[model samples]
Target: MPQTLDAAAVRTWCSLALEALGREREEIDAINVYPVADGDTGTNLYLTVESAAQAVEAVFAAHETGSSVPAPADVVRAMAHGALIGARGNSGTILAQLLRGMAERLGDGDHLAGALHRAATLAREAVAHPVEGTILSVAGAAAQAADAFPQDAVRAAYEGARQALDATPGQLAVLERAGVVDAGGRGLLMVLGALVEAVTGEAPVAPVLAHVRHEIGDPGLEPCAAGGPAFEVIYLLEADDAAVARLRTRLDGLGDSLVVVGGDGLWNVHVHVDDAGAAVEAGVEAGRPYRIRITHFDTTAPPREREQVQRAVVVVVPGEGLAGLCAEAGATTVLARPGEPPASGELVDAIRRAHAREVVLLPNSAELRHTAAAAAEQARTEGVRVALIPTRAAVQGIAALAVHEPDRRFDEDVVAMTAAAGATRYAELAVAERQSWTSAGVCQAGDVLGLIDGDVAVIGADLADTAEAVLDRMLAAGGELVTLVLGEDVPDGDAVADRLERYVRDGYLAVDTLVYRGGRGSTPLLVGVE
Candidate 1:
């Protein structure tokens, strides 16, 4: 009687799921009792899943006009692929894989018992060492329950997931400390919960997906809410698909809440253009755009300078940890990406959105020095000063954050603060679970990778080797003060430090390292020479 589902149903379900996630998103982040305490876990999951939801909307909308209908199969498949590339940290990676496995099960849109079983089995396989009381456990049990009552109960699948989630804290000691369930697991369950509610005739709770990742912009002087669509401008463009996409992308950097999703062979048209001539010329570069169907949306009769008041913020992350940490850092705006720096337009928009007199960008990854340079150039062109400090690593970003001075003017503090960071060395340890090539040498699965000044200097079978290599480089660079931030996975900070002390026994430098207990990650996990 009941089958896979319809598109309208899916969109409704997706929205409901996002709403539930937004409600309980933080609960998962609070589980870190000690050791590896990074705040981005929950936020990572939220953004990862949110990106998937956004992708679905974009894909579906295009499909409506003959784009492609991505059913359970397409939805999960695209989401998994996108999420994996867009994955932030450990939790985000696992979640992306889980989505991938689920998509495999629902391949070709068979929302039947067999499909459910296949998805469950695939999900279990994705996790190398599956932990109980987590999203995996909850998802596994729900799949099993659905197999048993495929016909008798339609909502059984969602309820099973919820039941499994309820026992999450009991499965992990850390979660028990927080007096809450697993945040990632809860987010997963909540999303599915919405699916259940949708099928059962319960009203779906819609989440605010469109607004969360808005251009960090000055809210403008005021909303056209004093009247209407702000600017009612129109323009016509005659360009190829490539040029149109490029132009569309640039508009994002220039303004806010822009809706310009229409382009074709000859004179493709449609736009709520904020600046008519700029929009038309952007398209005209490739060829000539005519008829431009131009009409400007005017709140002010003569039109006031359409400026948005906002801020730009940059963070260094390797996993979901980046999002959580940035949020806690009092960041008003955030964009999630891993390994590399965000583009020039992304940086410029951030500056404009923040209504920045001078934008401060922290390109935490060392290899991103060039990218930061590009961003700086763009900032300068816009008459906005961009203060970029090479935080080098996420640990460095965290450590340097203590010195952030929002109260001071941009010019004075940019110079003063950067000098402070230049005087210190950034050292961090992460597992070489993935293979990589670097100046450090060929990396293996079990090696503990050591990074110094943003380059891979050591990769060894033990953390001590990597730690020593990173420290030795820092010491050689002649920095008297070194701060080593310890992660959750690391054990015996003092013992490790002592071992290093023995390595450089010929003390020409006072290698004093401070260990702060915290979690560090960027959305793009691969950093430096990888």
Candidate 2:
């Protein structure tokens, strides 16, 4: 058989896997069926790999030795831990589990065949509900191939992964619908291909931030995955319209699942690739994750089980507006969730950052309360001051922020702010993603799903009717004050005021409200209808 695999061999495998993912990253993300909007599978897995890559580089940098074969066990362990901490979405979690499995395999033995078999078995276990046509199935098949034709030959491994990936479409329903194979599986293939190439004496051209470049180093074996980065990566892209479009397209090649959501002048690019260096270079060449807003997902979750720290206050918010509100309220730190709710791990990370010294965590969404509390409990042992005020919306969170005063002893303020938030009314005027039925009415895919306090109060083709139902519900609750914060799509402050005035001016809750819209700030319009 070929020479026993070493640290370099493992590095090559990861690089190949990431490269394969970069190639078909876009297709994989688009093929997802459950949540059509969550087209970030390729991106998620790619980021996880990229984290491992970074760790590997750090490992090697610390020990810049000769061409000596590093211990395979140590390298695999490092890579596994890196993947665990940098994981993002559901796909990212699965990928982390997959690498953890490989680490287990490596831990058990020093040979190549045994490690491959362990990975196959672990891949199978990682999926809670396994499917035939997905990455797990494909990876499993590849493992079997490695076991059978599975020589120490890395080339053979690449060919087998490819074959398995090709057969994925026939197995998975969603893949068939999207007319593509598994995205995650294709990513695995990239890792394998990279490995085969590396160990076979094929030198990579150069590392790219957007692409997975082979680097033989320890990826970090420690299980403790915490820490805010010393430096934040910022992306300042100056591109023409066509150039921006091309940059987005290129980002797909480097890694899929990049979020190109920012202002016209400055676009935000965040991609997790094997070669952070190469990825950054590519972004600079085209556009860049520069002007970096340190992703909460990248940083460690706040320690659960409070620590006996001196003091601290943490607040969870989505946009900059909410963040500012919390800051005004004396929140020591803002646990900002870019444009969505904080993930479970993210919540933990926030608490850890706050050091749990009287931390007050306001989960500004109804659905996110449970997750926030779960994280709070985990951090309870860490001496954290995490108070999970069930703020049902951004408005409520802001209300709580108004009364937050750290210097003042914990008194009626926390309770009052929290009560204000809980007592506050909430509503949304977003378009529907699917044809789902709600209490108000039947909503088609494109119809708007008007909501108030987590209930579908209205569903229609127009914003006016949706606004009426939402406003009416808020009024009926014996509450007169209202705040309507318009989203990105809804602009023209006058439109909301006029509509509310027309609908409820003569009614119980008059049109005495404040309407804010269109700002560099990101907050739900606090349509205060007092």
* Top candidate, metric lDDT: 2
Q: Which runs of model 2 end up more than 4 angstroms from their true locations?
A: 1-292, 295-313, 328-340, 491-494, 497-512, 516-530
TM-score of each: 0.41, 0.47
How many steric clashes does model 2 contain? 68
Error of 1 at 453 (Å): 38
How does each model score on lDDT?
A: 0.54, 0.58
lDDT, residue 77, model 2: 75
State the lDDT at 242 in candidate 2. Answer: 64
lDDT of 1 by residue, 308-404 (tens): 5333345544444444656577543344333323433344445555665566677666766765676677667768767788767665565455466
Residue 94, candidate 1: how far off, in angstroms? 2.6
